[model samples]
Target: MSKPEFNSLNAIFINCTLEKSPRVSHTSRLIDVSKGIMERENVSVDEIRFIDHEVPPGEKPDMTEYGWENDEWPELFKRVMKADILVFATPIWLGDKSSVAKKLIERLDGMSDKTNEKGQAIY
Candidate 1:
């Protein structure tokens, strides 16, 4: 068997650090490791630091009611839609995933029903 091909693959790493202005942290370290692995496979990588952005937490998926035009989530979702792979990088805090990570999941829940071109669920 030959190695799998990933020349056209694109990936996004959502770093869910709690710090508003996160400095070097464990979550970033994990992202670095993943980046190295993906780069070796020729996979394009993009990263998003949720804590650095104004990501308001709510159960609602779209932020239209809260002025979606100015929200960063819509743009982020668009990037996720275009990616072939998504890596959720979050540090476990007190036996739970980081709050930002949970918020990310909640935000994505609204897209769970949507399917990809291959008839697979996007979320």
Candidate 2:
């Protein structure tokens, strides 16, 4: 069978933090929101994404490459760009967006201007 067309259905929920004490871990709140969205949309009707951000400082324990650019980051970016809708779930820290979400957004800024070998933005 042929592969599904891009953007047929896609969504992402990136939680910035979930530390618990700090006004509740942002990830925890995001998961609740994500679950509701998935339920409302129905499991068979749409695709749902949940990006869990819960890691200690320094290199990512799940990482298996020299750097993110050479590893999962690329694939994750592709997924995000392919999505029809993107949701950024984060908490306010010191009256500002959580650092994790901020960094992810910053990383995504370059996606729009990029092009594939055939010259196509992921969006």
Candidate 3:
């Protein structure tokens, strides 16, 4: 079979389900939305990036060394840099996005355009 054409629709799913929030249900709902977009657009999806903010016991999740790419360091920024469109779907916690989502947002510093004084994206 021929390989499918790759179209851009970058997706980021962040789980912010406090300690008792229903996470999977919310995420499933978001997935349905993404699927609907894909079906409506008639474009092939290249990738879906899912970031789980819920950490394991005694472990810190950092973009620099998240173990997703071994101990080589720096993976999240690389992925973000390649995405053409970003979709951030996160559960609300304490009336705000989860800390994991916030961390992911902070990591966006590496992808900044660096032209604007306020770091407004030029791309």
CA lDDT of each candidate? 0.82, 0.53, 0.47
Q: In angstroms, how far off is 30's CA in candidate 1?
A: 1.2
Worst 10 residues of 1 by lDDT: 62-71
Query: Can you write out model 2's per-residue Cα lDDT over 11-121, one digit (the tens) per residue?
Result: 555555635433555456656767576656542222222234322222332233434333345556655666566667666768887766665665566455777788877
Tell me the tens digit of each residue's lDDT in model 3 across 17-92: 3334344456557656775776566544333233432222212334335444332114544454455555565667
The predicted structure with the larger lDDT, 1 or 3, is 1
**Model 3 whole-model lDDT (C-alpha atoms):** 0.47
RMSD (Å) per prediction: 2.4, 7.7, 8.1
Candidate 2 residue spans exceeding 4 A from truth: 1-8, 18-26, 43-71, 116-123
Clash pairs, model 3 backbone: none
Question: How many collisions per candidate?
Answer: 0, 2, 0
Order the candidates by lDDT, highest first — what do you get? 1, 2, 3
Model 3: worst 10 consecutive residues (lDDT sum): 52-61
- Name the runs in model 1 displaced over 4 angstroms: 67-70, 115-120
TM-scores of all candidate predictions against the true structure: 0.83, 0.55, 0.50
Evaluated against the true structure, the overall lDDT of model 1 is 0.82
Which of the two candidates, 2 or 3, achieves a greater lDDT against the reference? 2
